[model samples]
Target: MRSIAKPATQHTITANAKVVDQLPFQDRQAYADARQGFIGTIDPLVITDDSGRVVWDLEQYAFLQDESPTTVNPSLWRISQLHMAHGLFKVTDRIHQIRGFDISNMTVIEGESGYIIVDPLTSVECARAAIELVYDHLGERPIRAIIYTHSHADHFGGVKALIDEDDIHPGGVRVVAPSGFMEHTVSENVYAGNAMYRRAQYMYGQNLSVDPTGMVSTGLGIALSQGQISLIEPTDLISDSGQELVLDGVRIEFQFTPDSEAPAEMHFYIPEMRALCMAENVSHHMHNLYTPRGAQIRDAAAWSRYIDEAMRRYGHKSDVMFICHQWPVWGTDSIRDFLTEQRDLYRYIHDETLRLAAHGHTMVEIAEMIEFPEGLATTWTARGYYGSLNHNAKAVYQRYLGFFDGNPANLHPHPPVESARRYVDFMGGAEVILAKARRSFDDGDYRWVAQVVNHVVFADPDNTSARELQADALEQLGYQAESAPWRNFYLTGAQDLREGVRTDEATLGTSDVLSAMTTDMLFDYLAIRLNGPKASGRNFTVLVHVTDTGETRLAELIHGVLICTPVDGHADADTSVRLDKPTLTGLALGAATLTDAVSAGAVDLSGDDELVYDLFTLFDTFSRSFDIVTP
Candidate 1:
């Protein structure tokens, strides 16, 4: 990764920093609450995996030990300091949380015989470190059960860290999750996995150094750990609201909140402890309705409704409200107020965006027009640390109305490169655009400068002056951004423009995730990889026999679409191949070639080798470092 020049300071940026400093620094309640249940942390928190590769190192953020620098937003810096509070802390008598170990918290609840873990952190190494920390302070107890609140990889990707496949007994050690957990988990990570993983580099600031001007806290936490991720299928599924389960003498009730934070998400209530676990529904910061890394747009209406439902069901009964991301809310009044404010935040965004759209406003217009009411705006929880009102308002409009704003002009816009070239030509050339952009940059009109200079860069990618001006404009926007991901995206774009896009090789999915993928899920991923243009006018049928699973699939490519169905055998198939699931996985992941598999006796072929080779040729490999800021 290339090092970027320090962001240039402008009068507008300094004024923005002054405005942030004046806004409610007197509220020290969050700080007090964060340090409430402190126990102890491992001295010099540096964790490594079995291979001696560093997975997570809190020392990288040692700069946060100092006061907020002028380059960083004070509010975000405050949160970053709080997030630097790493260690094991007792949430209550039986419940404990290991915070700052990873991007998310790994919670442990003491059961009668053993322990029940909630959301093992993002990676195997982090989860293991967290568990070991608990065992060092508390006794080494067996893990009787594991619960995943949602389908996101960060919540359950560390299953192998705590327990093995042999430890799972039907009635002894249970793995629990909401309905559609496995489906959403596999679909989100497999079908669009390559693109999302690539964009995540920018979203999480993975390659950037930790500093005031570089990567700070991600609002939820520092960032994701670069360790191996694994997955385990859940044994129990919570389907509906009010679903109750008694495990290890602890009575727990579930509130299923599908399509809220995730496709399959739920909040649970522990009656005995009077504790409400809000999962990812109500984190410390405002969450994204549309994450920049890209996924299906989340339902704002559905999200608010679930929070309201939780309030009605457990708000009065719960004494402590703990979430997966940040600190807990202890008092009844505080918990209720927190839930209500969060609920209203989402509802306001949802309703106001729709209202503006109903009045014939475009997505961009609605986003610019809407603003949070004073009651929500002044509140700390409603601040745009993770999700910004600007983008989320657009996301709301997109939820009801799509990308098209009903304007015929935008209905069929030209591709980026063609449009950029035309725009540059209309503006007299790259030199004219650069002159105008330089004036805007000097005047601190970075938004306009970025927009104009983008056309110049796209029209003439090799123009050094155009690239430098664009990078400067982007860096200014990044310095003034309140949202961590917004800042990261801008800075990363600037870095890429200056140094050229990085071409680091990133592996798509881990072996545990591949092994857990269902046959249908694997086929869905394969269908995405199928190049429609390449397969056009080419019809073929193949029978795949998985010897280990004893299942066969018949695939047909017709009219530029691949359709696969489970079948016993296909007599008219052009080719038949016998391979185990592992070998098939290796083939899909590009780890094993058709020739290599055949030569090694891992794949047995019965018919036309050329046909099989041609089918493989139709599959397109995605590059992890595809260009984003440039055409």
Candidate 2:
């Protein structure tokens, strides 16, 4: 039968029951920790934008209070329940945190004069609401400084909401971050933003129905805040470890952990407050060695070492350890134990994956073979709620040995659709394969059923029977997934199979993100959008002069690539466009057309106006809601 979502099969129910049996579900430490310092929260904990659009609504997850259902993983259900603890909470007498407002936590440290804000949530509205909660309860204090703990958007995107742009100057509230923050931030969030943002929908399950049968939690937090994401460049950069900064009588010692969780990240210790902020390095569950949304493979070994260093440096002295996600860990002993388990979690994954690979194990085989030690396995914090061991083991393999597994047969294989067609033909056609897959599905082998039936569906997407069966298999897999993203991917795949891709949620207005881009950065992003085949054998040169910034750039599209260079002047330029940076950014971001800008006196074109317009035509607009489950 065709269905939107199916109930968990007996196999799935039994799988979830095994999870409850294996783990220490009776331990209430996480629950107690989540609610330790709860001051007050707006009942329903809803944050809306100025237009009344709901950005974050914790009330939707009111279903979490019920006992774990057969359709949901008990471990994931446990984390999702803990995440419902919303509002401003007192971490210590001098420290406070706004939790469950967004996917990430925003901490407020009371300085001698004002307040120090660390890692404001992902959206401006959510960050603003979080701070307002602090103001409402703790009384308003001047924001003395803003500290960004990492390069992730959730940590720094809401800077503009907390402090004014005019207040970013010297002798004003200082903004601090690790070195290479802007470079990584723009490259990850802008250059490859279209693809990353698209994958993020599936990873975060932003469009999934909220219930036991769909998205429950992100494994890290309840949900991502749907408000506008904004960023302000940091004034002060933390370059080296052991770096110290005293802002408004608060001393922060930084440990720069480059190429760990993020391309640019750090962990810092507040000596006076006795608080150590681990950033996103060590969280409640297993962190991603390779995030599904796509990025460079993170170094697992380096990730473990960073945790070890932080524990040695600050674990003893710290009264409380706060992370960018989930609740904080209190007491020196508890904090030390938490850090040790987390440290070993990454280390074991790294070491064992390599050890198995050395013994001639393929990436897929290594993923299946590696098992965590009992100590790391049983710990609630080490479990894979976000990043699973199966994917991470393969990630480490990819990082070291590359995608090739030394099998010449896999050196170059047919693409998905072609491969599926051949596989179906070899297996005696679609109906025959469906018969076998149904038996496997009935026998509770959903993973194998999903894999085999996928060939039939891809070979012929119009086959209703194949699509329905595949959807059923995926639903069963989703019901049994311990990792939130895994469940989202499986269910969302089933969703795509049933309902087709929803294209309306594809575009996000990135005007604020574009405004923060430097002239060079903007050109770099423009280059990424340049369709090589479209630009092939067509050459052009455009010289852009920003009237306000006095920055000039020469963009040459030749040999199927776009090359940009900073130039003071280019007399031989094919076209020279004089416009303000905002006007140029607006044109680049497709917010304003060249014809409109030129007519409105926003742009002045000296030569080859048609050529400039043609240059834009070579750029391709990316679809944010591309089909993933299908070709």
Best by lDDT: 2
User: What tens-digit string does per-residue lDDT give for candidate 1 at 1-631?
Assistant: 2446675476445756775665687888888888789888887988898989999999989999897776677777877887887889888879999999888998899999999999998899999989999999888989999999999878987889998888777666889899999888877867787888878888887766678787888877888887888888888999999999987878899999999989999999998899999999997778999999989889999999999999999999989998998888997888999999999999999999998899999999988889898888777898888888899999988888899999999999999899999999999999888887788888888899999989988988888899888988887777777788888888888889888887866556436876677776666677888899989999988898889998889888889988988997555688888999888877776556788988999999878878888988988878899998888
Most accurate candidate by TM-score: 1
Provide the clash count, candidate 1: 0
* Model 2 RMSD, rounded to 1 decimal: 1.6
Error of 1 at 481 (Å): 0.8
Model 2: lDDT equals 0.89
- Model 2's number of clashes is 0
True-structure lDDT of candidate 1: 0.86
Q: How well does candidate 1 match the true structure in TM-score terms?
A: 0.98
- Work out the TM-score per prediction: 0.98, 0.97
